[model samples]
Target: MKYNLFISLFVISICSVLAEVYFEEKFKDDSWEKNWVYSKHPGKEFGKFVRTAGKFFNNEEEDKGIQTSEDARFYAISRKFKPFSNEGKDLVIQFTVKHEQDIDCGGGYVKVFDCSLKEEDLHGETPYLLMFGPDICGPGRKIVHAIINYNGKNNLIKKEIACKDGVYSHAYTFVIKPDNTYEILIDGEKVEGGDIEADWDLLPPKTIKDPDAKKPEDWDDRATIPDPDDKKPEDWDQPEHIPDPEATKPDDWDDEMDGEWEPPQIDNPDYKGEWSPKQIDNPNYKGEWVHPEIPNPEYKADPALYKKPEICAIGFDLWQVKSGTIFDNILITDDLEYAKEQLKNLKDKQEGEKKAKQALDDAAKEKKSDEKDDDSEEDEDAEEDDVKPVEEPEHDEL
Candidate 1:
């Protein structure tokens, strides 16, 4: 048992030594401004961000994060980190988003840019290597976008990944492995994951329909055909509508006064729909004509599709009609374990925040209940005071 424990400790230490954290920001203090750059791109109304714990939180100081402070504006902000290449390692980008404002139409995702990006000029037009996070618009669209840029074209994931909603903070984690696979997590739970190439149109299909090929001239794809021997019934020709048998013409009815004295029309029970010969299986009918596929000469496999050779900056370039999204606990790393640990910490904070919020809600509810009771008592007292003792029946007789 002792030997096994020693071995386990050694392995843990080795794993810790291998993990590398490229960038991490908790927004613990006001000095974040020194590290982050706000875009000054012209003509766009950019919103400012405020650091606060919001209305309720676990801890006032520790929970403070940058929150969007404007409505119907663009938010462009980014920060630089040491350049890193994930050529043979896993890349994980994790962050916490608090939609305390109950955002209606806005983006809460982060974009990853290469070192070539000018932080001050970051905007919607700027290219990015990856974009991953929740985006909500109206009630229909509440999706987590996992977009990848390849060969200068942005390709969105083919699968739909639903995101968390409501006014609580949730952690979003995107993991890209060296094997070209990905996993998207919400609050430390895997929501969607699959091969990168299969989910994105980063490359031409391996096989494509042979444009030069055509169906044989005699090929009959129809599975059924009208039978030549079957004939329509004689009664099948009845009109759809006929004069009602039960409806009689009024005695006062006059053809000269009224345009017509016909009875109301009723559906004919004997009427059959449009007549046609019975259908039978066609003897010569062939199955569906499947287009043969051939190897696409344009397609070239990329083993490094998941690699970002010069990832050094991350940005938030979004348009929010309604703001108040708090972003915090941003972390980019090559270590999966480290990212998982960070997520665990976020989950803890979320639990604490929920307790705090519940307490506040309970207190407010109690106060309102007390106020209502006091009002009722006051109303009862006023009613008693307003009631004058019925004047004793004029007591002159007494």
Candidate 2:
């Protein structure tokens, strides 16, 4: 049994290593510009991208990626790969993003477009097969967008997935399976997953309320009703407000000169609110009348909801209020296990960034402390000089 288990583990490892990868971009160097095209579309201020690992990173060269260089501008850049369809396999989109600017309002997402999309023509209006990543605006709108194009319409995922809002690198993974189910991951942890149909309006529901079915005329759906036998108490009714006995009218000159004086009204202590008959278990209550459901005639089963016929291009077509978001390690593949393996180093990247940042912070704090010490010593010397008795002329003292 142990031998069989060992063989099984070996096979799984081999399969994971051999998983297919359709496209990947690490932006290792300036050569990335050769493959990525910038948008030249009219009537917009397009931002440029710089190759950098930013202020902190695990490995300088390995962590380097394309960073947005300008603020309050539109950025549209895309790279085209060999067209491929995820017909009978899982579609995995994984990438790492660092909002080094502590972005206030921006999109750190990538849009996946089909082969028909021109690299130069990519823009906000361009239709895409899938759009997945973090989008944040102010404090309330920090969320990961999982939008899929279905039958010429783009449907957004109804669920809200909170995104990492810090100034460190975070990995976002979206996996769509052939069975019309999906999984969303952040930093190698599963955050959300479910049936695509349930999460998005990709297809009409299989069953719907029957329009022909109607509630009977005598159907009593109320679970509770006022008891006819129980009447309101005689003193249950009371005015909501009453004149304050302690409040006396001001002793003024004459009623003719000024408005008539009256005591101010206050909340009545004896008030019992509005009077109503007590409720009891409803007789002949039928609970809720649920409409019978039938198989929707307009609904059709789509086994290909997961298919994107020709995904060939991936792009960043977004607007940013504050830029300096570095996008790196983008991967589009049909292998879930491979995508998982690729993201295994995400935690290390984040921890490395944290360590680097902490070092910088420590250095700054030490510098401040040293300056304070120097100031204190200088102040003490000045005090000593001030207190030192003036060397009066000895002859004058004599």
Q: What are the Cα lDDT values of the candidates?
A: 0.91, 0.91
Model 1 gets an lDDT of: 0.91
Q: What is the lDDT of residue 153 in candidate 2?
A: 99
* lDDT score at residue 69, model 2, on the 0-100 scale: 94
Question: Per-residue alpha-carbon lDDT of model 2 for 323-378, expressed as tens digits?
Answer: 89999999988777777778777788889999998898899999999999999999
Model 2, residue 25: C-alpha shift (Å)? 0.9
Each candidate structure's TM-score, on Cα atoms with residue i matched to residue i, is 0.90, 0.86
lDDT for 37 in candidate 1 is 97
Best by TM-score: 1
Residue pairs in steric clash, candidate 1? none
